[model samples]
Target: MGALEGRVAVVTGGTKGLGLKITEAFVAEGARVVVGARGGAGADGALAHLDGRAVFRQTDVRDPASVRALMEAAADRFGGVDVLMANAGLSRPGPAAGLAGADWAQVVDTNLNGLFHCVQAAVPYLERSGNGRIVTMSSALGSRPAPGASAYCATKAAVEMFSKVIALELAPKGIVVNCLAPGFVDEGMGRLLKQNQAVWSTYAPKVALGRMGTGREIAEAAVYLAGDAGAYVNGHVLEVNGGLAW
Candidate 1:
């Protein structure tokens, strides 16, 4: 049997990029996943290959009600949630000196506040599951510095610290909360960076492995964190950055 056989997972931003890959991996491992995105069509398109193991939900992670609905839908469809992948995020790249106020707000709202909304909505249900797991997304830049990504980096950094604090608070409640900090990944924002020759050239050699990590690699880490293998792991930030050096 698969590691996550008969498990139920809720993954936000699950319609594309890293989130989509994680959803696919979960389904492959025999988990029923509720995929959430702001656009219904995107959600539907992303997980169309999962057969009956996954469902699409219209969700705006920034809204607590929408996030709550997502968790409730998972329970109504496939029983209570065992895993919560708070992966919804966006980046508005610009230098801090000239960044637009709107861009900053959008990044902070979706990356930080949105994660809080999902966690708050999922906690009660997770508690009832008896073995709850939360995997929040962060970036290598969360701790490192990047010139044009101040807002994104700041929100991600905040997420790391938030995950640690919450992990401590929820450990006694039987919920394992951890953070996934990826660096130079080959999907989502990382994909966009690779398309820029100037950026990719600068970052490629920094990875000790000398290449970008794939979405599947990150997904595997997610599985470890959410599965029985991670039973004793909590309040940790697992970095899947291929050993990036300064």
Candidate 2:
């Protein structure tokens, strides 16, 4: 049997990018997943491959009610939620001086505030699961600080701190909280960054492995944290970077 066999999981922004990979990994490990997304062609298309192991729930993580409904859907469909992948996020790339207010709000609301909503909404169900796991997504940039990614970096850093604090608070309840800090992955925003010649040239040589990390690699880290291997690992930020130096 797979590590996640018999577990029920909810993944926010799960229909695409790294979130999609995590969802797919969890499902492959025998978890029944409820994928939460904002609803789009990409979301629907990506979910088609999961067969019936995963259900798509239109979720705006910024809205607590939407997140609550998503958790409830998992319980109604798969019994109870054992894992919460609070991974929904966005990037508004621009210099701090030139960043637009809308862009800032969009980044903070979806990246930081939205994750809080998901965690709060899922806690009740997760608490009942006995060995619940909450994995929040952050990025290498959370600690690295790039020129045009102030909002994204700040929100991610906040998420890491949030995860640490909550990990302690929720440990007694049998829920283990952790954060995944991926570095220069070849998916989602990182894919766009890699396609830019100037950016790629600047960042590629900095990785100790001399390459970008893959989505599957990050998914494996998620599986490790969510599965039995991570039962004793709490309040940890598992950096899945390819040994980044700069």
Candidate 3:
């Protein structure tokens, strides 16, 4: 039997990129997943192979009501929520000196506030699950400084601290909150960065592994955190960066 057999998971921004990989991994582990994203469920048959193990809900995590409905939909469909993967986030790259206020707000709203909304909305159901797990996404840049990524770095740093704080507050309620901090991955935003050879050349050597991390690698870390293996782990920020020196 799979490690997460019989569990129900809610994954935000699960329609594409790294989030999609995590969603697929959860289903493979025998969990029913409710995917929430602001956009449509990606290129038509993206999730068809899951064979009905996953369902999609149009969700805007920045909106409290939308996030609430997402959690409720998961409970209504899968019976109860055992895990929450708060993975919806975005980055607006620009130097702090010239960054637009609107861009900053957009990043903060989606990355920080949106995560808070999902956590708050899912807490009631998570509390009832008996063994609730929360895995919040962060980035290596959360702790390491990066030029022109002020918004992303700041929000991710906040996410790490926020996860730690909630871990303490919710531990007594049987809910474990942890953070997943990934380094330069080979997909999503990381892929975009690699497209610029000039930029990639400069940052590639920072990874001791000499390569970007894979989505599956990150997903496996998440599974460990959310499954029985992580029952005793809490209030921790698990960095999945391949030994990034920077």
Question: In model 1, where do residues sit more than 4 Å from their true spots?
Answer: none
Ranking by lDDT: 3, 2, 1
lDDT per model vs. reference: 0.92, 0.93, 0.93
User: Which ranges in model 3 have alpha carbons more than 4 Å from their true place?
Assistant: 41-44
**Cα deviation of 184 in candidate 3 (Å)?**
0.7
Q: After superposition, how far is residue 60 of candidate 3 from its true place, in Å?
A: 0.2
Range of the 10 consecutive residues with the lowest summed lDDT in candidate 3: 40-49
lDDT, residue 124, model 2? 96
- Clashing residue pairs, backbone N/CA/C < 3 A, model 1: none
For candidate 2, the per-residue lDDT at 223 reads 96
The superposed Cα distance between candidate 1 and the true structure at residue 65, in angstroms, equals 0.8
In the range 1-246, model 2's lDDT, one tens digit per residue, is 999999999999888889999999999998999999997667667878888898898989999998899999999998999999998999998999999999999999999999989989999999999989999999998888888899999999999999999999999999999999999898998899899989799889999999999999999999999998999999999999989987
Candidate 3, number of clashes: 0
Q: What TM-score goes with each of the models?
A: 0.98, 0.98, 0.98
